[model samples]
Each structure stands twice: as structure tokens, then as C-alpha cells.
Target: MQWIPDWGQARIESMVANRPDWCISRQRTWGVPMSLFVHKETQELHPRTLELMEEVAKRVEVDGIQAWWDLDSRDILGADADSYEKVPDTLDVWFDSGSTHSSVVDVRPEFAGHAADMYLEGSDQHRGWFMSSPDDLYRDEGQSALPPGTDPRLYRLMARAARCPSLSATPFLRRT
Candidate 1:
């Protein structure tokens, strides 16, 4: 493929060696907001954070993504909630796209909790979605971060706006 470079394996190896912890926070309104409460002074997640996160996730599963938006901090954190501030930021685009392995593929009983046969996205995803998805998959499922499918397809983007005449440009352009 014209897109595949001769030194691709070397680049991949370097990325593996130098990659940093994925920061999944994004300052946007289009995704599932990270359901976290931070201490106003300590600047840390609430001590009971995991319990609160589970509650928020349950609400999301039952009432849709907006459940977090509708919830008052006190509703989940109780009276002491006033001491903490709910993070208004949404999840990073990478985390949002990377989760499809679970949300789309594994959720169906027919899929046997495995990855899909193919994943097609823009070239920009090599670092964003491609990287984020597996990181999230392994974290959540304890399986190798790599999905069973091949590396996602990538195309040359036009400089004007990074448009991929073949796919929606938002996933590529937004991240760039």
C-alpha cells in the first residue's frame, strides 16, 4: 500500500518505548464527561471516587450519556459533595473512539467478546484512535490492547482541511 512506509516497524517500536500515560481528558462538550469529582484544595479525585464513578456509569447505562449532565454533585457524592467540584470536561477524543471495541464489538453476544474484523479510520488515528482503543481495551478487559483486526486503514488528508473524501473528516481534523 502506498501508505505503508518501509520503516513502519521501527516507528512502531519507538512509539511503544516512548509512549506516555494516556491523558483522557478533553475540554469539549461532545462526549461522555469524565465522571470525576476533585477536591477544591487538594486537587485530587475524591477518596470515594471509584464508588462514585461506578454510580455514574450505572446511571449512564440506564439513562443514557446525559445522565451525568443531569445529575447534581450532591446526588452522587452526598452532602459532602459541596466540597468537591465535578469535572465539566469531557473525555478525550481518543478514549471516545478507542472504546468502540467494547461498545460496538464485544457488547454483542454474537461477537464472542472479540474485536471486529476490520476498523477503518483516517490516518490521523494512528496515534489517536488506534492507540487509545487498545489502551482502553486492555485496561477494561485485561486482554492485550491489540484488537484481533489489522491496523486501521489510513488515507492521505488534504491540507486545506484534512478532508478524506472517503470518510468523515471530523475524527481527523478535530484531533489535529
Candidate 2:
């Protein structure tokens, strides 16, 4: 992958080599829900998780995300609702952003079965989106996220711009 600024490649390589595995779940009021059912006592996923998730997906497609929140556990779990509880955690922002290849880019009719050609991200994303995106792509497709010959670039915020008045309302970057 091609990165702007010669040092960017090394910086990203070092972060990837040293960073810890990211946690992909968080308890948040907003953001994509995990929509999982776990055993009340054991906290393990329900045995029929794939089937249940498909059911949830069908509902979500028709009614949007609020359908999951409004749904009663019993509606999906039947009598097992007493033993299985819905997981309230939402996916981490990094995980959600990282999976955009499959979730967004790859779903496009023109781009089916292909990876994105470019990924524009902030320089700070080396330890966040940069790492997570590649990892997710590799896990799902068994290859690096960037196709051969693709260029990946990161832009850093200008220090002076960050200190400017709030009226600017945008982080200016010093593109190299």
C-alpha cells in the first residue's frame, strides 16, 4: 500500500506490530446494536444464533433499527426468553467503520466482490480504523484489504488550525 509522507508507512507498520487487539463491543445508547442473545447464567451465545440473527436482519430490513429495540425477547426466543437475554452492547465504532468494505463498499452493485481502491482516513487512524479495517478485510476475505497497486493515505491535522477559533469548525490539515 502507498502512504503519503515517507514516515507514514513506518509509523503505521510500527503501530500495527505493537498495538493490542481492539475490543469490538461497547454499551452505548446509539450506534449499531450487536443484536445477540446470550444465556442468562452462562453468558454464551444462543445455540441458534445464526438463525436468530437472520430473523433479526429480516425485521431490521423491513422496519429499521428501532425494530430491534421495540421487539420483545419472547417474540424471537419464545419461552427461552426467560433463560436468554438480549445483549445490550453495540459494536465499537472502530469495528463498525472497519467493516465498511463488506457492509458498504462491497455491497454496491458495481463493486460486488471487489475491495475498495482508496481509503481516506485521518493520520490518527493508524491505531484505529487503519488497523481495524485491514484486519476485518483479511478475516472476511483471506487477503489484505487493499488490492495490489492501491494507495492508502492519511492526513494530519495542522497544529495551528487546531488552536484557531471555533468559528473555523473544521480541522485543517497539512497535506504532504
Candidate 3:
């Protein structure tokens, strides 16, 4: 929510225009399920949905999202199965992009202990990857590599010394 840009808000008249729809349906079968059930007749979420979602999330945590795909409506909705339909949609592209840092840095070790030194891209990156990467970084950790309240001078010196093997010895002579 904090990611919304003031400039974009000023340009758009309605809230709907500013945010993308959460629709997850897709023609392909290679991602997380939308995790929603709709009324077969009304094509909307079934009543007592929040309870159902919590149950589904528990299963997802234990067995992964694929479990949702394998689940039967009767198991998830019980008596409502006759009236409701499962939505076959999955996650949005941005969700995957945004979660990379969490999945990579926090949950996975491929990017752990590594700091993103620079992000180079076209201007659109400000609204796309660049924006999402920082958000993901902060979500995993309260602050970034150079978080506030840390000494900038010391940080830079340490970073420089870390990269230079010869810095193991004192670089400058100290006059006693």
C-alpha cells in the first residue's frame, strides 16, 4: 500500500485505476493456485469463505499449493460444494517477482548473505523489478544493507577492507 506513488495517484482519478486486479485465472498450469472458490451459480466466493481459506492455507503450508489443486470441493466446502465452484486462477506476475527476495534471501540460501550492490535497468524498472526487489528486501528484514542508524563511514571502510585481501594488515602508519 505504501508503494503507491503520489504521481500515479494524481494522474488517476479512481482507486481501481491505480491498483491491478487480483484475478489469478490463467490458461497455463505452472504456478500457485488462486486459492479461491466461487458460487457455481453466481461465480462469486462462497459464504463462510474466510474459514475455508484458513483451512486451505493450513493444507498449503503442510503440503504446498499443489494440494489445493488436488483438493476436492467436497473436502474444502463440505455442504457448499454443490453450489460453489473452484477458481483455477493462480498468482500474479508481480507476486512472484516480489517474493523472489523472500524466497531467495530468507527462505533459500542462494542469495543469502549477499547484498544487492546495484540494480541497473530502464526507467520502467522504478515501477517494476526495482520497486518490488526493495519491498521484498525490507519485508524479509526491517532494513536494507545500509540501514539507518549505522555509521556510513565505518560501513564503507569495512566493505572496502572486506574486498581487499591486503587490508588484513593496518593500511596506514599510526604515530604514537
Best by lDDT: 2
Scored by CA lDDT, what does every candidate get? 0.66, 0.74, 0.56
State TM-scores per candidate.
0.68, 0.80, 0.50
True-vs-predicted CA distance for residue 168, candidate 3, Å: 28
Cα distance off (Å), candidate 1, residue 157: 11
Give per-residue CA lDDT, model 3, range 1-176, as digits (tens).
Answer: 21133343333234334656544346468787767888877787777778888899899999997889899999977888888888877776655664554454555455555544333233333444444554555644576642343221111134455567655221121111
Name the weakest run of 10 consecutive residues (lDDT summed) in model 3: 167-176
Q: Where is model 1 more than 4 Å wrong at Cα?
A: 1-7, 18-21, 140-176
Q: How many backbone clashes does candidate 3 have?
A: 3
Candidate number that wins on TM-score, 1 or 2: 2
Clashing pairs in 3: 24-89, 24-90, 25-89
Q: Report RMSD (Å) for each prediction in the order shown.
A: 6.2, 5.4, 11.9
lDDT of 3: 0.56
Worst 10 residues of 2 by lDDT: 167-176
Please give, for residues 37-71, the per-residue lDDT of candidate 2 as tens digits.
99989999999999999999899999999888988
